[model samples]
Target: MKSWSVVTDHREWHQGDLALPSDPRAWYQLGAVGGWQVVVADTPRTVAHDIVTARTTGRAGQTAAWCSLPFAVPVLCTLATGTGVAALQTAVKAASAEGLPLHRAVVALTVIGEGRLPPLVRAAATMLQSQVSAVVTVPFDPHIRAHGLAQAERLGRRTAETGASLATAVLSAAHRAWGDPLPPASVPAAVSAPAHAVV
Candidate 1:
């Protein structure tokens, strides 16, 4: 129901050098300040998996068994363009058969040339809508030197009618999404600190 954004690199994702905000609190604060939910992570898949796993389990893990808990909000997974729609559909169908419970899907519009939101995006959104709670579009570019925000806004507006969340990726060194909003009872009393903790 709320608009959200996730900040990650548009180029290849490296596990150790993620350019994101520093902590979980910072991530929540950014969402609060921007009046939109924000998801920050070391990698896009990690973030997505965190959300999915958190929904299913109170904690995060690398295995499917870790995703046994039920998800509170809709869970979205990235389906970048050029990955072949048929492959995606097949994967989706297989996941469905296995009862993976993926709630939604996202596609990055930054891949399109000339900063244009093509019909393919809308069509994919439409198709995926029936299978998931919503289809979101993220305006991302590794090079956001000029017209980045403007392009994101334009794509967002174009897809507004589909009831999907519109978002853009930003690079921050001090804010990041940690497994907050965890079922209160599930949180441990002395959890380990984040990797980028301030000394």
Candidate 2:
């Protein structure tokens, strides 16, 4: 069985953080508030940039948990644009059609600045909340102005490799933690028993 381990890149940050879940259930519970969820396509790669820069590898699952809440928050980690929004809408429709709980599905969009943010962030944010007082939307913190934005830089680069690695790591860890291996086998009913014991 594969276990989630950390990867590091020393040149990045002095703080070499290990990507572990402080609370996986918390992440999932918070995410469930949203109806359906997707992360920006390549989430691991996005975190990798920082890892590469920092010279460290984190347990892949921990990093993914940190990146976004997939079960609760459908992440759309893409460059903010008109096309991105359209793609997001399609994903939302599909998730909804597939019977994902949409009571409060929040579409999290990644953006570098005021320019690229999809015009629909405002529109999408309120979608669930307005319809069913139970729903709400959350935008990526655009105003969190960092002095030297290394974390922010990598946060936007979602790609297939990163996404797959991160997802595998998380699920692998979850399965291991939950003891999800094949069940035990049963004895044959035809086997004979001791006569004294039967009596």
- Top model by lDDT, which number? 1
Candidate 1 regions exceeding 4 Å error are 1-66, 69-87, 104-110, 140-185, 189-199
For candidate 2, write residues 22-52 as lDDT tens digits: 6554534433343223222223333324323
Winning candidate number (TM-score): 1
Residue 118 in model 1: shift from native, Å? 4.3
- TM values, all candidates: 0.40, 0.31
**TM-score of candidate 1 to 2 decimals:** 0.40
With candidate 1 superimposed using the best TM-score fit, by how many Å does residue 189's alpha carbon deviate from the native? 5.7
How big is the RMSD of model 2?
A: 16.7
Q: Candidate 1 lDDT, tens digit per residue, 33-143? A: 655433433223343334455456765333233233222232334434544344455545655654654443333333433465556655666786677544555444444
Output the lDDT of residue 68, model 2: 38
